[model samples]
Structure formats: structure tokens, C-alpha cells
Target: MNALSIDIEVNEAHLRQQFEDCSDIVFRSFKLSDGAMLLLVYLDGLTHVQSVEDNILRPLLFNGLPQGEKPVPSLAERMKREWLPLANVQTVDSSDALVQHILRGSLGLLVNGEAAALIAQIPGFEERSIQEPKKEATLRGSKEGFVENLRTNTSLLRRRIIHEDLKMESFTIGSYTQTEVVLAYVKGLADENVLSEVRKKLGQIDMKGIIDSAYLEEWLEGSSYSIFSQIQNTERPDIVAASLLEGKVTLIANGSPFALILPITFWSGLQSADDYFERFVFVILTRAVRYAMTFISFALPAIYVALSTFHPEMVPANLMISIATARENSPFPTVIEVFIMMFIFDALQEAGVHLPNQLGPVGSIIGALVIGQAAVEAGIISTPIIIVISLTGIAAFTIPRYSATMPFRLTRYMILFITGFLGFVGFAYGIIFLLIHLVMLESFGTPFFRPVAPFDGRRIKDIFIRYPFWIKNGRNKKGGQQ
Candidate 1:
């Protein structure tokens, strides 16, 4: 409410009441030529200073009013067409529009006698320029990314899809923050229930701010307590558009680099945008490699523990002899040694992520050499444990979504704990428990483990090894089915 004031045909007293408790507000009394009333407003950065001087002040002072003013129309209409930067403001009786205008980065101008005041739309802002998506990059697709500007991000989608049916619906979720959020999906392709569920969940959020899509996403889909992110987060518009085409819903919020792709299952997380970029054979091979890595990231430590501790004969005879010889000098039990090494490996990975860009590689090198040499020298852990931990870290990195790797990282520990206690049975129990939890999870009311649990063969074209482009028909047949 930082507006310069002069009420011409408008109630000055009532205008004051509209902005009563607002402290940032400023007002100045002014006059128009030939005894006519006039008011001007500059709400901090909401009104451009230059535009106010040229469009508003200069016109009122220099540019003669409708010359023979027969009482300029309504206050709102007069200011909208006649005033410079204040063109788009709407006037209301209950102070709602004025309040809404102020909140939306516009300044309101009130005048005496006239029922309406000028509301100018001049949104000054600081936002990042479009850049390559850091998290969701694809070799063969669009390089453009979602910026902080919500309108600009939506425009990015419009540019790509270019369909009138591809709708972008907007709303504000936070109570105090008044953050803007938009939902984009193809009209007929996207499920109404999915969209409704997303909107309902977002409306239910009790938080004071919506700084990132993850906040809305966490509130909207799956359990907040689960380790896996039930909603897929991607920055690529192509990926988002693809999801929309397949009846998946997308949530884009102001001030977030990523968009939320709903109903993201375990398999969806494993698949990447790049999977569609490559040929069928290569895509399937890469998919298999990623699946194998998921197993490695989770079960390797437990399986190793199980074999070394309980089933020595499980390892080939030659391999068993070598492993036993290596562990001969180790002072700690295999379980403790394995657990400690895994902890160190995890510490190094987390540190690498959080450290300065320059220090990240250095931390990795230090973790590799310093830990390996010391553990082997002290006989606290065998050299082979270092290899296992290193491989586990690499396996976790293979998955495209970094967040998805976290659950597997957690799984690795559970697998270790289980193996340490009940050997193979505990390992099996952990895996089964994880599957049950995943099956229990639903993203926007759709099963998290979609195709596999739903047992739909038609969706396999896009799920497992994607069929050739000609054979695939470029649609998810199961998406629209009940």
C-alpha cells in the first residue's frame, strides 16, 4: 500500500480503511489541473518509477484531461485507459480487488466521488533466466529448463505442446505466502480423478509457504514418512509433456527448478528420458543395467555378509579360500567391519554432494585412498570390503534420479542389519518388506508400482524394453483404462 494519493470523486476516508493496518503503505495528497481531483501510487517496486512519471504524473500535469471533462467515466475505467502504468487494475467496493492488486505486485489508486480506483499492473521481479536442466538432462531432447518465473515456465510448456487442449490451470496453495502454482495436462488424455486428487491434496497442505514443488508433491502423493519419493521430480519440459501425454499429471510451482510428475513408481524412477532417446536394444540394455545397479546398491552388502558369515560354502571353493585368507588378519567380525565400511562410504558420498565443487573430487579421492590404506593396514577391514563399498557407491550413482538412489541406500543398511542378525532370512525379509511398502504407496491415488503390480502386458512397451517406435504407437494404452 505504498501509493501517492489524491482522491478525485473517490472517498479518501474509506480508501484509508481499505489499507488500514498495512505499515509499508505511503500516500500523498495531490491535485489535477483546473481543480479536478487526482491520485497516484507507487507500491515499492510494484510500480516502475519511470512509468509513473511519464504515464501518470506527466499526463495529469501536462497532457490536458479529456480537455472538456464531462466527469471522466468511472474512477477505475478513467485510470485504466487514461493513466500510464496503472492500466490493468480492477476496482471493487469491499477492498478485495485493492488488496488482491497490492498482493499481486500492483499499486491501487483511489479517488473521491468515483466508486472505482485505478489498479495498475506493473510487476517488477527478480527471476533466473532459462538454463539447461541440471537434474533432468536428455541428449536428444529440448535443453530448455524450468525457471523461477511461473508464467515463463508455463509458456515453455505451451511452446512445446502447442495444443489448446493442453491446459494449464493455476491456483495459490499457501495461506500466507500466496505462492502461485500451475497444473498442466492434456485434456482428454489426463485422468480427471488424478488431477482432482492432486488439486485436493495441494489444497489440504497446512504449510505457510510453497517454495518448491517438492513441498506440494510431498503433501499430495504417498507417505511423507517413506524413503522413496513417490512423485518423480524432473526439470525437462519434454519429460513433463510426455508424462502429460501418457495421462500423468504435472505440477509446476513458482520458485522451483523441478516439476512434479505424479504416479511415479519404482519402475518409472528406474527409467530415464534418455531411455527413449536411444534405440530399443540399447535402451533395454541400459534399463537392465540400471535394474542390476538397483539390486547392487541395495542387496550387495547384505548378500556379501550372508555369504561370508553364515554360508561360507555358498561362495565358489577358490573364491572362498581367497576371501578367508584375506580376512585372516581382520580384527573385527565380518558384520562390524562391513557395517563400518558402508558407513564410511555413505559419509564420503554425502560429503561429496554437500562440499564445494572444487572439494568434491578431492573428498572422493581421500575417501578412496585414505580409508582403503588405513583399513587394510590396521586389519580392521579387509581390502575386499573397500571394493564392495566402492562398487555399491558406483551402483547407487547409476540411477538417473539422485533422490531415488536414497531409498536403495537405506535398503543397503537394512539388508546389512538383516544379514548381520539372521543371515539370508533377514535379507529376504527386508526385500519383501520393501516391496510391500512400495505396493502400499499410491501416487495421486494411482498404484506406485503400476504395470508390474497391475499386471498389464500392454503397458510393457513403455515399461520394460520399449518396443520400436513404429510398433509402440506412441501411447500408453493402460493409462486411460480403469
Candidate 2:
């Protein structure tokens, strides 16, 4: 039967059977001063042993109930009202719920004749201390980042936005893991439609396990096939608080250090945490340079290949001569040279990422210099091709978000191949196709390329330039505050 029995022996037997072979489960049985049987169930390392000893056990075994007081109708109520010295306490009537509570690091107490159990909140498992964000570091903003503990992460957000409007709804995902996922948003600021969509998508997830925030990210995205990430992720609590103020929804999963933000725009990927903290004039200039670098990183290789192969006349005479002379000794065409170097460059980058931290940067830098010089000396690749690929790699690092840079980096090769075959026509077609795809994309019902494709003049300024906080007024139509 799912319901707890009035007999304590039956309940203890069922609980022990449910936790069969689990070495970590702790069961403490003793007799109260009134000669009544009592049982305590908790996880060994998860529940706070010191609190249980001082609060529940000491008061019950030594102090007993108050003298000359009328007896309560039920033992569970008596303990809850006058005996237990814990802050949070609740009662569960079913075996399943009692087991669930015990598994979540709570202490469960069973009385001899009662059909209910008292659960005390005493989670004390070890967790990492809060540290500065490693991925999105900012010089001026707060250095604190989210941690794996769900309550700790929520507390971080609470410390930033101290308002009653900030609401956090909880959900339990993963049948096996039973991981906790929290959805955070402001009451009046967040759009009801977007919030509904997020809830619907989350309900549709039927996964067996959710190990990290990325697992939810994959399921919550509008399109699975799109290269661009529809939801933005950050480790900083300030970013999450800012997104909530702008009427966006955020998801924080248990055992994950990153939090996911939804209904993001194309321009959001180009923006950085430092932009909001810096002066508006300086930020505008930095953003302009970043945009230019993004373009060069994506299209530079294709443009060079098309001009050298089919539109050589468009190039300057002196540069054209130099390129031709460099490729004279190379056996393969310009396209092959570019492709080979690109593959090697990508391999080196991957190796660097997987290596130990101390060796990663050193290995990538030394490997690139040695490989490039060797390939050029052997005449397998032209000097000009190496320079072009190097410039493209350097320019790619300028993009603020790593997820945003991936699409451009991957698509660059496809455009290079097409341009090599069909010349300038292929380059133009590729650019047009990319723009159309972006315009058609959506993030939880909000346009992915908003303000630019739809031509919103008021919000466009925030894309290319950052206006002073005093000058900006009201919220954008979508999920951003102007």
C-alpha cells in the first residue's frame, strides 16, 4: 500500500525495503522518556547530523513533552508544535512522499502509532564555494557567479534584485535523477505569451535524466536544426538579474553552474558584460570594431578565394602579383590550400582546449607557428593563404559570445568552397541565404533578428550603439530594456 500504516514496524519495513542495499541510508531507532518507540531516517552525509542531535534527539530523549499540558490528539502534531526545534518542518502521509523527502536530505521521524511522518529540512551536503566566473569575466561588475547548488544560485539572484515582483517557479525533471529546475522571471515585465511557451516546452520534456543546463537548452530551443543558439547562457548573476529586468525568462538547473536566458536577439550575442559597465561613448566605439571584426572573420576567406580565382582584376595589381608569385611553387589550387590550413588550425584549437590549462595556450601558439612555417617552406601551402587564415582566426576571437562565433566559424568553410567554384555569385548568395535564415528564426516566439529585419527604429540604436542609462527610457517591444 502507498499509504503509511498506523503500525510503525510496517512503515520501517517498507522504508528499509525501498532503500535496499543503499549503504548511505541511516536509520536510528530509540525509545522516548514516555516509553514510546521513535525512529529517525536520513541520508548519512546529506542531512545535518549535528542539528539532528541537538534539536530533535536531545529535546525528545532528555526534555520530553511539557509537564501539566493537555495531551495532543496525535503524536506527530505534538512533536511538530512543541518538541522539534527546527525552522522548517512538515508532515507526509504517504510512503512515497516520505521516501522522497528523506532522499532530498531531510530528516524523517516516525512515531509508533501515527500514520504520518515529520520531515525536517536539514540539508548539509558539501558544495563548492562561490567563485568568480571563469568564462564571462568583467573588470568592473560583480565577480560572484552561480554555483551548482540551486538554493545558492537563487540566493545570488535575490541579493541583486530585491523586489517582490521577481518570481521563481520550481519543477522536478528527470525520472531517474529527479533534478530540480527553476524558472525565474518578473511578474509584470515578462511577457505572458513567452512565459507560457517556456512552460509548455518544459512540460513536453520527457527525458530520463538532466545532467546540466545544456540538456534543457537543447530541448527548449525553437528549432533543433538551427546553428545559432536561441537561448543565451551565462554564469554571472548580474546578467541573469539584468535579463529579468528586461522581461526575459531564465532557467537554473541543479548541479549546473550556468543559467539559461531565453528570447535572445542576434545583437545580444554581439554584446558583452563589459559594455553595460563602461562609458557609452567608449562602448559604442568598441562595439563598432567588434562588428567589423565579426564580418571579416566570416567572409574574409571567401572574398580572397573568389577574387584570386575568378575576379583577379578587382584586386590591386601589386597585391595580385605578390599572391600569384607566392602560389607559383604550390601544387594545389588556392581553395585546397585554404581548406588544408583551416583543418590544421581547427585541430590545434581543439587540442588546446582539451589539454591541461598550463599547457593549452603554449601548445596552441607554438604548434601554429611551427606548422605554418613548415608548410610554407615545403611549398605545400602559399604564404598568402597562411596570412589569410591567420587573420580570420584572430578576427573570430573578437566576437563577445563563444556560442555566436561557432556558427560563423563553421559556415565560413562552406562559403569558401562555394565561392571557389562559382566566384563572386556564390559569395553573394551565401550572405543572402544566411540573412534569410536568421530572419526566419525565433526564440520562444520572439524574433531572432528583431529590430533589424522588422525595422524598429527606436530599438536599432541599442544594437549598434549604447546610449547612456539616463537617456534610455521604457522597455523594448521584445525582451530587452532600452
Per-model C-alpha RMSD: 4.1, 3.0
The C-alpha local distance difference test score for the whole of candidate 2 amounts to 0.90
Candidate 1: misplaced stretches above 4 Å? 1-29, 64-71, 82-87, 474-482
- TM-score list, all predictions: 0.89, 0.95
Candidate 1 lDDT tens digits, 19-45: 678665556556666666655544665
Instruction: Give the Å shift of residue 238 in candidate 1.
Output: 1.3
TM-score for candidate 1, please give it: 0.89
| Model 2 lDDT per residue over 80-187, tens place | 676456658888999999998888899999888889888888988999999998878887899999999999999999999999999999999999888999999999
Candidate maximizing lDDT: 2
lDDT of each candidate versus the true structure: 0.77, 0.90
Best by the TM-score measure: 2
